[model samples]
Target: MAPLSKDPATLATQGKKAMDESKYDEALTLYTAAIDIRPNSPLFYLQRSICHQRLQKGQEAVDDAEIALYLAEKLGKRDLKAQAQLRRGIGYFFLHRLGDALQCLKWSKKLDEKEKSLNLWFPKVEVGLSKLEEGDERANATVPELPDVSDKIAAEKPSTPAPVSNASPAASTAVKQATGVTTPVDKIREEMIQNNTHVTWTLYVKGVPKDKASVIMEPRSFHISFPLANGSEYSIDKDPLFAEIDVDNSRSSVLSTKIELHMKKKVEGKKWLAMEAKEEDVKAEQASAPVNKPAAAPSYPTSSRTGPKNWDTIVTDVNDDEEEGDPVNSLFKTIFKNADDDTKRAMMKSYVESQGTALSTNWEEVGKKKMEVTPPEGMEAKPYEM
Candidate 1:
């Protein structure tokens, strides 16, 4: 038959299948051909590195992993880079560079502590280092014997799900089909926190295996299922998300502490006020949301001993005097300009509220009580009786 199809996606899928069957050598050959056809794919390089790691070729593994990490960094793919660093650390372990291997593995954990593979190697590396520190010269620290199906134990992730979009990076995680109706049972505890561009649901399920869990990502909903430690299955199903999400960018991870499910917000900068939407979600959200408006200019600074003064009214009074050419008004304006902040405040409060019957400079007494019109001895102050 003619050589395997030239399509990189087909070759990648084939390589994954071979690795699943423990045919790592054949997987390596297929991935190499895939890399030749599309040399820029960090995903392909990373997969090839996995092949070398399984075949126990230390240098070749590191070589491919280095290329994968370099390309991953260029692509700004933290997830892919974490996997690359993890495999590179394994390569260093096979080469007997325990110190370098430990460093790479720790860095990989820092990149993504939830990568899962770090859990397996951390204890093994620590034990080996402890023996070396104790001066055990003959203690060659190698991983446990590789078994036919033990790849499940060491693999960074489960076999690639054959999602329809073979060329997309999301093909790495095919949306799993729900086995049955999945609902959160009383046995599990779940918490969700919404962020601006992303939302995360945290599940605290004890003794959850990485391979035992499954996730289904969709634009408006998601479902996740896993077998619990107590010989029962647990699941969380949200059919209607509070808002739409980018299904392609959504992902999940499991850790010893909790299981984290992340979904990217479909509308950038849109806040999901709640985890589930309702008929009145929009109205309630708008009512509770803070109004973000441009700030108003601050009032003119004043050392008024009483309280805030109507500086706008004072300015308008000055303008009126200029237009009318009132001698009394001009004289009062001169007095106002010469007064201190407190004196000016008392003049405005007493003059305005007293209806021009008084203009006081005593700020200390004016602030003690509200100003009231005190008509001359012969006059009586009356509201709306002017």
Candidate 2:
């Protein structure tokens, strides 16, 4: 019989299947074949890395995860990139690299909140930090006591539930008094602030069109805000954005804390340069007397529109690719430039798929015990020394 034929996508899918079956070595072989066929496709590397993690090869898992993240970002797959960051964070966590793990998780969290699945894992980080802090405190012969709030709330409330009033005079007056001042629109900022308590700090993106800009949050419940329209506001939950973190007691150690805003002014600057070059080209064409061609219709790439309208949701189907124009390419551009209502849905979907795949794959096997390299040790000499 002829040798079996295998393609990259096939290999990748096979690897994924094997991983699901917990046949990690078989999965690694398939993933390796997939990567050999298509080295730049981050999915293959990410899957292989997952297998490495499962085998307890923390450093190798980190290495592949880093490659996956860099490639994903370069390919404009923000979601996959964020997933890679998360994988890296997990690897770091296993290796006892708390600061690095915190940074990766924080950044990945900033890219998308749904990616905040890592939030539950953060309690582990906190536990590790607590242990370390306790050890340090023990070494120093001092430790702070935990705070309590239960008794204060008990003292404030009498031992009875307040009676519900159906239109009593005092209740009506109270409702009337409150109704005049607090519309839902007026309460948006207040509500956001109240719900955002884990937000130890924020960075405001400045000097961009309010409607055309976006904020990327990191590591769960953290936010980076910017002014939107009117007195109204918009914030990017760190939940979904990729970030790097270095958490310390001082606020100064925060990641991207100074707020490096990549303003639209930068785009305008590029436009200015392009116009200058275009003017020179126009002059050269004029001198060549082919100016009769009416300048070839200005040659700008037409922007394509084929995506959903929501910011927090993304919808995808294979059928979506059949429409005219390159949706993926356009969507990719929109993410780097600015995440608009038109592009936000596709962006979210892209991230969801990319990250979803990365997380579900067998990454932990890379660091698992079965795959570990044990060094050769000398056997007992059968009492010859005696």
Number of colliding residue pairs in each model: 0, 46
Model 1 C-alpha lDDT versus the unseen true structure: 0.63
**Clash tally for model 1:** 0
Work out the TM-score per prediction: 0.37, 0.35
Give the number of the best model, judged by lDDT.
1
How do the residues 7-102 of candidate 2 rate in per-residue lDDT, one tens digit apiece?
Answer: 554566567778888788888877766555445555566788889887778887877787777656656667777788788877776676766677
lDDT of 1 by residue, 23-127 (tens): 888998788776665555667778898888777788888877877776666556677678888887778777767766787887789898756456546544554
Q: In candidate 2, which residue ranges exceed 4 Å CA deviation? A: 1-5, 133-386
Give residue 352's lDDT in candidate 1 (0 to 100).
Answer: 62
lDDT of each: 0.63, 0.45
